[model samples]
Target: MRFDQQFLEDIRNRVSLSDVVGRRVTWDRRKSQPGKGDFWACCPFHSEKSPSFHVDERRNRYKCFGCGESGDHFKFLMETEGLSFPEAVEELASSAGISLPAPDPQAAFKAAKRNSLTDICEMAVRYFQQVLQSPAGRSAQEYVQRRGLSAETLSEFQFGFAPPGRDNLKTALLAKDVTEAELVEVGLLIKPEDGRPSYDRFRNRLMIPIHDERGRAVAFGGRTMDPDGQPKYLNSPETPIFHKGTMLFNVHRARKPAFDAGQAIVVEGYMDAIALSQVGIKGTVASLGTAFTEDQILRLWKFSDEPVICFDGDVAGISAAHRAVDRILPALTSGKSFQFAFLPDGQDPDDVINAGGVSAMYAEIERALPLSEVVWQRETSQARIDTPERKAALEKAVEDLVGTIKDERIQKRYRMDLRLKLSNLFYEESRRNRGPAQKGGGGGGWRNNKQGGDEDRASTARMEAPDTPAYGVERSFCTMCLMFPELFERHFERISQLTYSNELHSMFMTALVRIATDLAEGTVTQIYNKLDERFYKILQEAIVSSRPDEDSSKASTLQRWDTLTNRLQILKEDPPEDFVEHLFLNYADMLELRMLEMELEHETRAMEENLTEESWSRFQALKQDLTRRREDCLRDEQELAERGTKMKLNKAAMRG
Candidate 1:
């Protein structure tokens, strides 16, 4: 369904854009605009040397000068993180405390079908929970007890038991008025080729309800209590709501703590996540009975830049770590890091936590190796570098890995370090292989090949480098002004219309137009009061960037005021018919009158304090000028109102 623009704007008004962006980025406040109150951060949208991203709180919009990218909160989320429009809208709406409109009837119908399925799954979980308390579930209960799972852990993970009989779940769901179609859709009940009624898909097994991040139970994984079972563990097939690859078991409980801790511990199984949490390592997530996917890595990256992969220290565990390293390396750069931790042989996180304690687990985590070490070991170990061909192959592998890095400085550093290590290993290996006849050469063909590979790897690394730009302090100040409009308006006349590129100039001009319109409508205060968090951040950033100081002398202020009045007259010469244009003109005239009144008040106060003839004369002149300008402004306003009314009448007559 298409979300209306007004609804989107309402959501934007409630949610802070800075808060949302700040969750994923570190915002640096520029020193020059600290008092003005603006935030500056490197642009997340693109690579840049300095922060050119401007967020105008007064206007409730953000624009990046480097990329010419501008948008409201929803657009920012959609573009910055590559989320779907609906997803972006939903995220903002949740942040803004706004309820989404009901889906279309057609969409609602489909949603209801899914809800029906979810209801059946809920019934199944309840049924299994009840079964676990029954005599028939004695074996399942025994299995849990043997695993040393506490009652609290079991309940939190929704651990349950499927009854021994095949038709137990079917009868239970049917009793709850769940339709046969929904039971099949939820993957709890299976339909046979004979077109008969549903039967339990899982029987005589210990049940674990798999929940998504929202805590909605979408599927189940069942482990056999009896050794005679064909498959040791059975899981729900891919259904309407459950995709094994994307779902992370226990993420609903782990996400917040992980975000707060600035790290996430990824385990290999549901029990591992449950066990880790039971032992006080609460920030733990597990794959849903499958291997990790790139999508899962990306999702985890949203929460924390550092993710620790805790796997078994067996051959399979090593293999899994290698695979994870391969999947995660391309996404790794300056801001993010990954690590791999291998448990003692044949031990998973659950076994270690249960055997030693939480400290043991922490020790393991502390000893985790960096991703670079893992990659280097994995690549170098597999290659036979005794021959020139093998050395060339190893060099090529290193190049491929280095090429995956997006940051030039990081790539260069890693390449040099790896080359030195490889060179040392090659020299040692060559020395061992040398014979009496090869004394002069010392190292064999491998040593020469390694030397050549190291040079080539270093040369290949230099091919891709980053471009740098010269950042200007004035441009940064202008960005600050764009972010803080209240301060801009306070010193509007004093600000010089500095020369800038078309893009930066247009962004600043739009902000000025918005501020003028808001002031004219007598809604400037209301605008900030009602602004969304995102826009408020933009405003704060602008204010902080502009560095508006209040120290204007009476004479200089009045001269600037005259210049602004003249400019406003020109701006209003051919005002458009739109409400915004009329508002700007009105605000410009009011600003001029306000300045004149301030001057008159200052001069009058000075004359009273000094009681000098010259001061009295200056006060009289200022007062007269203020009175005449006020009258002239009032007349101009009246004329504009009359003209507007006449135009409206003319349009109405033409329509009639």
Candidate 2:
């Protein structure tokens, strides 16, 4: 009966949310925009004349402003018809013409055991609540008062206490016909190896029930009253019904509020969660343990768009936050990521509230940093970047980390943002250390000169030779442009990339690009007049390798280049549009191939320098892309030749 998210989304995407909800309520014409996939209707859960129920087809979710009811297609059907989760999914799938996956017997058996264990845990919850209200719970009552917890919070969270004994919970549950093995299975009792008898896991401690998303009690967290307790905090051991890594405390209660506020807060423990919730910050949950797993991170996304991990600003908190970045990177997509908030040193959620009340805690939340900033800080905060080798190492480390991101668009963005920061950092350091002689020099190689500089050269060098092997490709791209200067108008983006193997070709292209763009209706003589003496002087030497047998005399060098362009025009008589596209694709693909090969080679060297899973995966991805693009390049040429042959045959028949 368990369905993955993809299957649910598949059904949701196929059916219109409004069509489903329309069956229950009439649409409000004054506020609805059917074309935009936004609709407003009256509350289906409660009676209201004014429409507060909204269905947004773009998000495929409906929200009720009156009753505070919100959910998706399946949730709507389940709530309206009083159907179970599986029945609702089956209804949606049948309507959407989608088939459900076959049921798994193993999964069904596991679900049955989990449901049974949950029942026992519920029984334990009742026992704890009873003892909490009895005379034996007087100590627990005083402790809640000392912590500034109100009567409402104590009753709302079902706060309880475990008596100081080996068989307090066991004896109570056994009298209810709960077997000893069932108690042990749900982590309520601890079985010893010495054949001594199983006892209660939590003793003389404050108890908080851990609930699943559906608000089913599955486990418990206990905090000790003794100041010198060996472990100040303890959580339930893993059971069929409870998984520490997969569940977050207070998530069930926080989900709706988090959705309304468009944010979620994460603390370390359930105590922090209670403190924040008591202070009216209800859109908060706590990671069950020290480790934040992939499943928990995704669950946070379900409640809020950008969930913030609020931790203390001390060393331990910052270190823990840094470790979380790696776990989040591989799963990052376009807009999905975590923000981090650090409380002041020597402060927890309780301390923050005590010192400044709720507004002060809100201020801390306002200062939360984005996940990208955390990545930058984690990389540059501790490393030494005073030397080129160190700088290269830093860049390589960041590249490897960014490469772990599965989304190509997000990975490219991280590269751009971090590289800009790196440039500024290095530039400031250079300015501070630069002597009087180096002041006139500008920083223009990679960043200011179109984002290709020392970093590209260092990170993507060929393994075979010290010099780049992409020179021939760069030379051809330049020659084609010098012949067909009109190419500047059409393929501006690729030309501007200037990802060249040689500096002189890149410089020449930059100069030509400026003349083509900056000048208004540039004529041949106007272009010649605009060229500086030094630039005109090296135009021949820069292009000498393109034509070695030609004379290098300064007299007719410019004339010789013009002559070659005319000759190419006469010899190439294909259709203009096809010819131009072919030329652009050929040049662009060659440049890309050369650059990618060098990057692949350099990645091998980088792996040898520091072998890691991220680097190895990146290298393999580059190789795959290179193979795919190489085939695409050949396909382009073949398609072009077929078009050319068809053109020739059609013209011949027309003449006949």
**lDDT of the candidates, in the order given:** 0.63, 0.72
- Model 2 lDDT tens row, 1-656: 78999999999999999999998789999999999999998776654547888999999999998667899998887655434588779888999999988769997787778888999988888888888889988888788888899889887788888988899999999998989999998999999999998999999888889998767899998888777875777889998888888888987788767765567899988889899999999989998875789988877776665789999889998888988999999888644778888888879989999988888888788667778767877887676767877877887788789889998766755654455445544553454367654331122221122232222221211112214566555655665664343454457777777577766666767776675554434323334444443333233322222221212253233333322233233212334443555756676887878779889999999999999999999999999999998898788768766766766676456334
- Cα RMSD of all models vs. native, in order, equals 23.1, 21.8
Q: What's model 2's overall lDDT?
A: 0.72
lDDT string for model 1 (284-318, tens) is: 88887666787788777655666888989888988
Q: Which residue pairs in candidate 2 collide?
A: none
558 in model 1: Cα distance from truth in Å? 76
Cα error, candidate 1, residue 489 (Å): 43
Worst 10 residues of 1 by lDDT: 462-471
The numbered model that scores best in lDDT is 2
Instruction: Quote the positional error of residue 612 for candidate 2 in Å.
Output: 69
